[model samples]
Target: MAKPRRGVQFQHRGSNHHNGRRPSISESDSVSEPGSPTGAAMNGKLETSKEEDESPPQSEYEKKKQNFITRAIWTLVMMAAFFTAMFSGHLYIIAIITGIQVMSFKEVIAIANVPSRAKNLRFTRSLNWYFLGTTMYFLYGESVIYYFKHIVLVDKVLLPFATHHRFISFMLYVIGFVFFVGSLQKGHYRFQFTQFAWTHMALYLIVVQAHFVMNNIFEGMIWFFLPASLVITNDIFAYICGIAFGRTQLIKLSPKKTVEGFVGAWVCTIFFGFAMTNVLMRYKYFICPVNDLGANIFTGLECTPNPVFIPQAYHIPSIVTDIPLPGSLHIPSIVHVAPMQFHILVFATFASLIAPFGGFFASGLKRTFKVKDFGESIPGHGGITDRMDCQFIMGFFAFMYYQSFIAVYKANVGDVIQTAIQGLDHEEMVEVVKGLSKHLVNQGVVQETVLECWTGVVGNRR
Candidate 1:
């Protein structure tokens, strides 16, 4: 063993353990001058600082392994809860989404609340929550009116609220805005404004994007599940491929992301989407639009399958047909595939290529805050926001894409009822109802006696 350096002394492990006795001044190499109370206090602070600077007892790898185990457990738990909600009914899925939005918004808003609390700004968190509630009210109200207008339009209690929803939402936001401005302190104006902007950002990112996701669920569970599943599949394959073959870095924001992993995951996701779509299409519960929130996997739902879900044949392009090939090989002139498969390719591509940017955005945000995670809500998995960063963007894209490309637009019973109720006077409405009843009578759908009864009732009411 080498000799000890000058001015450095090593003590035996048991030397300081005797009788719980405090070490002498010289033994501790005291910086305090001869019992000066101030010096003692300074020395205590120094010791505290040193203790804090010491490494944690757990090894780095041990900590990482423990975190991994916790993360795995939570992931399984979340999956189980998600599948359970999915099978429960549309309402349960909507509830889960609503809860996720609230929790994610809380996690995001909490990050900025530190300064507000330091300044004793009483309404910072209040304003954030107020904005969130207002946004949810507006969004949920819009969705309810759009999807469930048949239910709401007939109900006297909900009709006025449904019709004036946008105005109500706007007024609610204005109230919050005015309150925020009034509560701004002299020195905290900048911080208050920043918080206001931050709150809006969170609302848009977490609440607004999530609103589209909820709408996707209403359109059909597949619209929600397929896109979500694609993102998750890509994420998993990306990790697997990265560990297996990752070499070149893909992005500066997420250092671990690699080009090999990205492309490999994209390929895997496309295949996964195709297979999952085929599986999901077989079930009316997943494929049909949500006409009844109470309907579940067991209860099922009924709708004519969308045209995209029907298999169609496409002729091979002449350019491809003309390509030289081996004499033994034959390329079919026509191939059968559901148009939805073509759409799935696009969805998978977006999930694999674009959605990861959302995660990168979250990573950059954490770096800006100098935080390793958003919060400890999920143990090793970090906050809900962290896990859902990509899902928000993915769901938003799915909604827009479905609307533009896949959704069939046509009038339904709700539209006819709404038009009759809103556009016609009482006499005109009676006349319209009588005309419909007469048409039904001629079609043999309603008996002639029923039409007579309806005619008599309408004329008397008029």
Candidate 2:
């Protein structure tokens, strides 16, 4: 290579340099990139950037850690609420539920693909109706209790209720439902808040009263936890099964929900219902009894009877009496007796079956809304309603079951004579029956032949 061009740089190789060993870098520097000092600095920069840009992608472990931490926090907050509801009970729950309802309603109204112009009006009406519904609920509950304590044991309104109260309550519920469904309606969806408001008021009034009656009767947390447990458990088990091995689509509407999930969920529901039925019914131990209501609305057996024979005295033995100072105490029996076994099973089975219907109904509603998730409020899950939508449906169903099935009390002399005395007496019931028989006879509807059905149905239902 003619001894190569020697300077600060050199091409050193085997003696057969012409065979091409080229240049080599050393402490003195022989590379062609730049000056030794400058090159070192530039290499440092390049290496640093390479390190920065090409650092290993976050490990799956790290991503999972972040996700877990996030979900844990969320779960903790929600679990706290549930625990509080379990502990603090009805009043607190009512507050929590009301707030949740408001939020759910707002979300529904805002998200529905309705015209912009109608949004304000619909939203206003929905809000108005929400307050109205809540007000009606409070009034209905108070009125029912008040009347129940004073009048004949009937539905929430009062004794001798004409079709007027029934119709009004029904109309309220219908109106509330309308406000929602009307808002959801497409094409002919005019967002008629007036009609919606009226219907909801009617329907919800009846339903709320019914809800109170059911909870009051059943000496359990069935009204609260029954629906929540069934629906939530169904959803949870279904998802778990679906994720593990999903095959056939459960529904054309939500293709992601599989038949495997449905079966798993349904089975889970039965087991859950059976197990929770007892637990939830027993949970009444933690709740404050509102009145002399029985373990369940229908049974009319006071679960927490006003602490009869309270141990107000401390007994002394003969030895203590002899001592004249020290005394040994004898404790009296203390118990919080529940209703009959049949009553518990009756409430449990009824709530159990009704709960599933509520879940199915929710699924149908979700399908109607064409949504997989209601909102992103809960990461790794969905909205509160998305999580609890089925519970609401189930609650309504249980409430209706309670009202339709358990609300009325046809007295037997020994069942709850005391409670009956507070409400309807035999004389009043006989009078109502008499009035109905006469009215029907005058109308020529029964010809006095079928007056029994008229009084039974009319006197009871109305």
Candidate 3:
């Protein structure tokens, strides 16, 4: 047979051309077959190129549309959760706020602990968390003491802690500070101290503001609900208005925000705020303070509604109306507007105008860190801090606004009962009743005969 091809000679083993075997092909003469290593690599590259060509990349518009849809769905879910919590009870809302606080703290701490800066530090991470715990304890303790003092003080276990909460909080902080200082290294001092400042700032901004939000809840659900609702409403309207008519950029800090959007949102928010307040004021569940820990939507609560919730008749001024009423005839227009409407307008204004600054501040923070979002905790919504940046500021402002303008001091019977029972022993309580009876008799609020009958009943019980 003709000499076998050099590369194919291996298949004809025993019949050799030289020394019972075919001569090996020279490296220059060898040709790569389709199944060879070089051929397989070329095939793989061709397949990869085909795949890249077949699948088109997503355009910017498509990406934005997908993001918007995702955000809208999650926003609806969040709204559902908020309304469910609002209807559940004040305690449920408090729980939600507390959850938010913890998550926000975690996100902020993660941002502060950059790998390069935190790698050399030994105690920085531990100290940061310790300080967070200490600060949360102090801030949350203050809120509990102020809002739920009755319940806290009456519990024997909680009373001592509640009484010395400030001192205990300070001691806890001091211990952490001492540990932090003791563990400091020569080269890592700057990073450790920077982290220390960052931790406290996060605590103040996140925890302290959130405490005021809880305070707003206790003051009355309306105080919490209306301001929160206004902010949500403003955010929605602002986005809508921005997309529809936005032209001039409002601020450098937030490039997307627009002057038209800002103004339009304010007008729409004011109207929405007024309308929502009108509706919510009619429901005692939405307007009442959480006096009972166990109170819920099912059980309901009863209270003399705040004067703001009560509609008052105001005589219409004749300045705008062409028709003049006779001086003798006092024409009173039966206006069904709540006094809270005026205050809601103020809140709406802030939600539309000033609250956006909080978002701008967050935007600046993200820019400084060169991050797209604070964290990817909320899918399309960025992070909890991003969503709540404006809210904490708004909630704090609502608390201050209520305290300054709208709050009225009304004696609550539950408060009085708690105070009387908290510190008094059985004998002391009996003496208090006796003293109260005599005082009532002296004030003509109780009869001597009634006092005698009460005393006899007490004696029989003993």
Q: Cα miss at 145, model 1 (Å)?
A: 0.3
TM-score of 2: 0.49
Model 1: per-residue lDDT, tens digit, 172-259?
A: 9999989988898888778788888998999999999999999999999999999999999999999999999999999999999999
Please give the distance, in angstroms, between residue 256's alpha carbon in candidate 1 and its true position after superposition.
Answer: 0.7
* lDDT (Cα atoms) of all candidates against the true structure: 0.90, 0.54, 0.83
Structure candidate 3, residue pairs in collision = none
Reference-based lDDT, residue 307, model 2:
22
TM per model?
Answer: 0.87, 0.49, 0.80
Q: How would you encode candidate 3's per-residue C-alpha lDDT over 1-462 as one tens digit per residue? A: 887577554543645233655545632123335477765675687689879999989999999999999999998899899889888888899999999998998888787677876766666777777887888889888877877776787688998898799999999999998898898888777877788788888888888899899899887888898888888899999999999999999999888999999999999999998888878888787788777767777888898887877877776766534456678555454466678878888999999999989989988988888887888888899889989989999999999998888888766654665667666788787888898899999999989998898899889999
Q: How many steric overlaps are in each model, in order?
A: 0, 28, 0
Q: What TM value does model 3 have?
A: 0.80
- The reply for model 1, stretches above 4 Å from the true place, is 1-56, 115-119, 317-329
* Runs with alpha carbons beyond 4 Å of true place in candidate 2: 1-69, 113-115, 118-219, 279-289, 292-372, 376-380, 403-462
Cα error, candidate 3, residue 182 (Å): 1.6
Pick by lDDT: 1 or 2, better one: 1
